[model samples]
Target: MSKALEPAGPSDGVNRWGLVDLFAGCGGASAGFLATGAFDHLWAADNDRWAAATYEKNLGHEVATVDLLEVAESSADVWAAGIRARHRGPICLVGGPPCQGFSSHVKVRGDSRGRNTLYGAFVTLAIALEPEVVVIENVPDLFATRNWELFADARSRLSDAGYRVRARILNFAEFGVPQERFRAVVIASRADHPEVRFPAPTHAQGAFSSVQEWIGELSPVASGEVAEDDAMHQASRHSKATLEIIRQVPADGGNRPIGVGPECLDRTRTSHGGYTDVYGRLAWQTTAPTITARCRTPSCGRFIHPEQHRGLTAREAALLQTFPSNWHFVGPFDDRFKQIGNAVPPLAARRIAEAVLSGGSHSEAGVVEIGDEPIGSSFSVLIPGIRRRGGRLAEGN
Candidate 1:
């Protein structure tokens, strides 16, 4: 669902903070930085041509389609050199290296140990470029027991390079996004700068956004139907049998009945139950589950629409992830899904940037204890209370 590319914003030569996105997946992080009005995107690099192209289209920013390994190990260093030539000052470096190799959900054909090396590539580039700040985003498993070695190495390297680094796991739903996506974020600043802190949650529990809140405005489309007006609104085509099975499931967050479809049961291999999210529908009143790269396919996750018998459209998924409805994604259908799913939710990233630039900690009462606090409480009041030893709140008088 590609749209007309907007012209890039003209630089005003105001010495704005510059940013370089290494694994810039379709400008998700860049969009967040731009929204803050405190930074300018100087350059973006991603090995995926489709991702880089989509980034260029939406942000009108120059994206270098290059691999990080080559940038780290090779003597050519063209990518790094080009940034130095243009930006000239200490720029911020941000990226989330591919997480498939380190994700807990990925159980076969990969090992977290092998993927740990990629973090080194980021560290190497950071040292070479000497950016004022370094930010790395990845799955929460990157800090889990099995992958702690990699996380430890990243910390040691940043310390050796003279930057003070800290890591936090942030939930998108807590930041007003309609989807439930958790990411491990590490922020490192030059030793002399104020220590970086995780951004505080702006919304909590019932106050969080729901699926209907984000995508309710779009017109409904049946399976295989494309809204000619909005390309992204087109639905994934399913077979007649598939549609029948989807229709049988109860609307609003219902899982496919066990043994109802061979394709859904195949994963269990003769067992009665398995992945519950497959062929499931979203609940209009609740937040969406994590929007994966394969979310456009019903079998990927709980991607089916609440009332519609079809998987989520690309635009719907993007909106659930807090992307602007007008922002366009390039490439064919599948690639657009990958770009959108892999992106950091812009709203979450904006709060992070605000905290980082202000030298303030995003320390809120609770990280994301959804459903614990009342919905109508004032955010200003929520910000100052600290959690006591017994997990009770010590409120201000």
Candidate 2:
């Protein structure tokens, strides 16, 4: 059964891929990977119990509720063996670690120790499992940070381990995702001919057709559009002044509709000036602003739900995340929002996964490897390091 796994086509055959989704949150990434029916997901992990439960119930993946580092260390070997015994080739891994340390939303302290270390955990597992391929994804801000050099070290470590690594920042909007989200994706191959390429954007940019295009169909919900289902989808009503400005914005007008004149402008905002994209309406024909964990708040982004006077519902956000209408999210409403906001849009993920999985120029072995050491952290391997599945793995001498 191993090595016989088939890539699920757009429809025809079942896509069967062996996978372990680390940092799996509500199965968004897995949803993307599975949307094309490309792979059979085997396992997923997140320390958050609710997230694990949600993933388990929704995607049918075996969910593990534990820290990534601890779980990988304890059962890496068995995990590898189970994968080998069950599927073909080494397993493929996908996920992005928490971006809190690198996000502008949070304060970065002490050289990003907490944040940098998280990336280290991903690197540690890659080295131990020696998986045939690894797919790492994160926000655009993740690349903006010099404080965390895990990307550099990870590239180098993969290179040394007989792999070929490709890291680049990609804008999701260009890749056919309805929103204008940007991300950083790194694809490493343990194959002889490693091909790394970003997915081409299927959407064309037009003045009338920017980020608000997809959100126009939703029933108009306001900043307070919370349903009994998910509280996070409740839009935070704007202040009187903000609402006044919002009222002026035409149905088709965005932030541009209401200029930041003296009354609309805050003296303190001369520097940053105005909410970045929050409390802004979506153009009837354009894509929405990049969906965020705070996507439910009209005050947070241009999330004013299309026609609804309030922000989007959790379901609407998931729609923007490219989740199919019939697919399910298993968790509290707010939690589902976090999962959707945190996901790699299924359409985006599927396209990228297709490229990485089939981008090989040759049928021969491929190895994804790093080329240099990162600005911070150790790339050298020591004996008896952590494992992937469960239980301790002996290190190489």
RMSD of 2: 11.0
For model 1, the stretches where C-alpha displacement exceeds 4 angstroms are 1-15, 76-82, 88-90, 99-116, 263-273, 361-397
lDDT of 1: 0.73
- Residue 244, model 1: lDDT of 82
Candidate 1 residue 80 C-alpha distance from true site, Å: 4.6
Instruction: List all candidate RMSDs to the true structure.
Output: 7.8, 11.0
Question: Looking at model 2, which ten-residue stretch has the lowest summed lDDT?
Answer: 382-391
User: What TM-score goes with each of the models?
Assistant: 0.81, 0.74
Tens-digit per-residue lDDT, 1-397, candidate 2: 1011123555433335567778887777787676555566676778777777767776767777766655444665765566567666446788787544334312533444432355666766776766677889885444444524546656777888888777654556555676756566778888664555555445544432243444444444465555455443445555676566556554543552434433344433455564545566665566666788887655566766444455567767776777665446666656767777887787777777666556645321111112242212321121013113111112220
Q: What's the distance in Å from true for residue 104, model 2?
A: 22
Candidate 1: tens digits of C-alpha lDDT, residues 139-220: 7666665566566766777889899877655666777878767666888898876676667777776666889888887898
Top candidate on lDDT is: 1
**What C-alpha lDDT, on a 0 to 100 scale, does residue 45 get in candidate 2?**
78
